[model samples]
Target: MATVNLDLTPIHQCSADGCTFNASASCHAPAITVGDHGANHCATFLGIPTKHSPTNDGHVGACQLSDCSHNADLTCTASTIEVGTSAGGGTECLTYSAA
Candidate 1:
């Protein structure tokens, strides 16, 4: 399958409003990954967002959110998304949406 680099420069907020990593300007995490639906959780599987590009169909690997309700498919299904710093020290998403 062909790979397409996802532009993480668009996100500017974290879905988890209580997260400390979320700043008023941008995400505090060093890196982030696009969720199957939107952006809702840090990509810590490897402690960082994978370098793989998104597919044309918009499906990626398993999501990294440990507390997500739809974590079964490793995908997100929220209306909006949130950004924040990973558990370590990088930019990440705290919420996502399929819409």
Candidate 2:
């Protein structure tokens, strides 16, 4: 397997305890995707047991919300973002804003 490095926006906080990449309220995934299925939700969120490597820092690698102000060419340009449980029973990016 090959790893691709990118200058991505960091995930400042994540309150989704059910997520595998959440560690102590912080995201530990190497990268996360937002706006999956054409919705402003965290597509990378997995409600599975067991956690990933804590040493891995989480970043917003991609975003599908083209209307979001923080989205630039399908990539998140926010300085930082927060992930949390949404009202519809899905994880979402709380930092999402209209352009």
Candidate 3:
């Protein structure tokens, strides 16, 4: 199988203990998608047991919230970001701001 390499740049700080990709306050996922289904939330978030402290840090691969000020060309331009729970459910980008 061919492995695809992602050259992610945006920094994503994941603080959700329930996320399988969170490791030592950092995100370990190869890439993470921000903005929920028609809402501001972390859609890539997955709840699982046995959290492993992965060495790789998470990157904001994409942002669907077109109204967010940090979004540019469908990508997140924030220098830093965080993932946390919201009233909707799961994780949401704490740094999200209106344009």
Candidate 4:
């Protein structure tokens, strides 16, 4: 039996079609990092053409959005985060909000 530890994992929903970690519109990386890489994006993003897919769910590992309320010491404090390109392009944390 597998014990679910909520504290050890962070729910991260990604909707980047070209991302290698994106599987069925969800991120399959074990962990993801959000930062200002050409505008707050999923630093873990890898184009599908550049690699294969993952077999696991993604969790928010770190966040560099200092203006966001979920950012605590460069880490994401949110229990869950959404990643999308609608926020002015690129893979950005849709859940990012003003502090």
TM-score of each: 0.32, 0.90, 0.82, 0.78
Q: Compared to the true structure, candidate 1 yields what TM-score?
A: 0.32
- The reply for model 2, stretches above 4 Å from the true place, is 1-6
lDDT by residue (tens digit), candidate 3, 1-99? 223245454445666878888777788776778877668877888888877567556788889999999899878887778888776665888898999
Arrange candidates by lDDT, highest first: which order?
Answer: 2, 3, 4, 1
Q: Please identify which of the two predictions, 2 or 4, would achieve the higher TM-score against the true structure.
A: 2
Clashing pairs in 2: none
Candidate 1: where is the Cα deviation over 4 Å?
1-41, 44-62, 86-90, 96-99
RMSD to the true structure for each prediction, in A, is 9.6, 1.8, 2.7, 3.6
- C-alpha lDDT (0 to 100) for residue 58 of candidate 4: 75
Candidate 4 C-alpha lDDT tens digits along 1-67: 2233345336556778888878777777777778864257778888757545556567877777788
Q: What lDDT score belongs to each candidate, Candidate 1 first?
A: 0.43, 0.88, 0.77, 0.73
Which is the winner by lDDT between candidate 3 and candidate 4? 3
Candidate with more favorable, higher lDDT: 1 or 3 = 3
Top TM-score model: 2
lDDT: worst 10-residue window of model 3: 1-10
TM-score, candidate 4, is: 0.78
